[model samples]
Target: MTRRHTTRSSVPRTAVRVLLGAAMTWAGISHLTVAREEFRAQVPEFVPLDPDVTVLASGVAEISLGAALVLLVRRQATVGWVAAVFFTAIFPGNIAQWMHHRDGFGLDTDTKRFVRLLFQPVLIAVALWATNALRSRR
Candidate 1:
């Protein structure tokens, strides 16, 4: 069996990747289980589907993206790009939460919810950085 090479330069990137991957996994689980209702609270009322189904689908996507980040080193850039897009796609949910003044999972106040919405961009940056997608091309 062949082992994947670990470059010294990638240590920090790898750590961030692991954190992103774990976050996705945790969010995925929350969507499916303990925090499912909380996730539903984030669903934009404009979206037509039953909130449960949307939550389930998003949960599955999170798990898949999370697994890809953790397992597909060779495809990290692609995973990262997808991760970025995934976070972008979900931004509306954050917006909805803020607009509706919904509360859940430690974001029990309008200020907390608004502040939480700001973190989506940070997550995107972390994804890109973790995959080195933002590094200068050789």
Candidate 2:
């Protein structure tokens, strides 16, 4: 008989994961509704799709990922990696926002936008850390 050994996340990690998931879900919903125009401002001019379409698609993706993060405890590592990648993928849009001086989400000043750019990596790291993605499987 084979015994299954399941590792449990620490309390802090679980809390962080839930918070991140909730935040992402809220942001995604905003992307589709109240903050649609603000989100569109983040889409880089170089992206081929129309800004609204990109916003909508990304909103859907965020919602799915957020749900996965919260509900898929066993698959948390995978979700974490995906979330990290998503954050990385959208980083260029943040840069574009800074470069183009597009105002959105209270990032009215260039310094504010530039400072916001620094948070993407933090979010990526948090996602990975919260889900044990940074840990090695034994």
Candidate 3:
């Protein structure tokens, strides 16, 4: 009989991953509900889709990705990579929000919006690290 060995992430990584997932899920719900208008501020004018539609679609995406992160323990690395890519893909919206000085989610000031931009990379890194995507398997 052949046995398969599975690797588990450290406690801190697991905690972070779960927390990130929960946060994403909550944000997704907000996008579809109370924070719909706030989320619209993040959609760039150049985007082909309407701002509301974009926000809704991204919300669905976030919900799915967030669920995957929490449920797909065996595929954490893959989920992490996907989450990182999603963060990268949405980065332009952050830039647009900052440049246009859109007021949403308490990011009224340019400094606040610009400062918020700095956190995207950190989220990407956290997703990767929490999923063990940044580690090499021996």
Candidate 4:
């Protein structure tokens, strides 16, 4: 079998990926700095490690994943898959926060928290679409 090469993806694809990457980078920065303690409120109570550890580790993961998404253009599909998985993985924390009524990032109202919950899947879809990971099995 011969290997296929992709020089560059479409402008829209690149834009979406870059935007998502930048958002993640910003979030990771907040996680490690000013919003560190606030981020802990989103950690699920069942997580075995301290909430701070979870927040910090997730911050690192976000930064790494974000950078990968931004830089790994040749492997867009792979990066998208990882980013989607990461989004899926952290969804529970969002759920826990919503369910527990933990306030952060101005999501003080229950309605706001619930509305935010709906965006998680959208992020996953954007990740896949931006990286061309969403494909038909033709």
Best by lDDT: 2
Model 4: per-residue lDDT, tens digit, 42-81? 9999999999999999999999889889999878888899
Which stretches of candidate 1 lie above 4 Å from their native place?
1-7, 136-138
* TM-score pick, better of 3 and 4: 3
lDDT of 2 by residue, 1-138 (tens): 989654555878989999999999999999899999999889999999999999999999999999998999989999999999999999999999999999999999999999999999999999999999989443
Task: Compute the lDDT of residue 47 as modeled in candidate 2.
Answer: 99
Model 3 over residues 26-135: C-alpha lDDT tens digits?
99989899999999999999999989999999999999989988999989999999999999999999999999999999999999999999999999999999988978
Compared with the true structure, the alpha-carbon lDDT of candidate 4 equals: 0.91
| lDDT for residue 127 in candidate 3, whole number 0-100 | 94
Model 2 clash pairs are none
User: How many pairs of residues collide in each model?
Assistant: 0, 0, 0, 0
**What is the full ranking by TM-score, best candidate first?**
2, 3, 1, 4
lDDT of each: 0.90, 0.94, 0.93, 0.91
What is candidate 1's lDDT per residue for 1-138, written digit by digit as tens? 998888997999998898889889888988999989889988999889998999999999999999889999888988999999999999999999889888877888899998998899999999998998777333
Superior candidate under lDDT, 2 versus 4: 2
How high a TM-score does candidate 3 get? 0.92
> Which candidate leads the pack in TM-score?
2
The Cα error of candidate 3 at residue 106, in Å, is 0.3
**lDDT rank order:** 2, 3, 4, 1
What TM-score would every model get versus the actual structure? 0.91, 0.93, 0.92, 0.90
Worst 10 residues of 2 by lDDT: 4-13
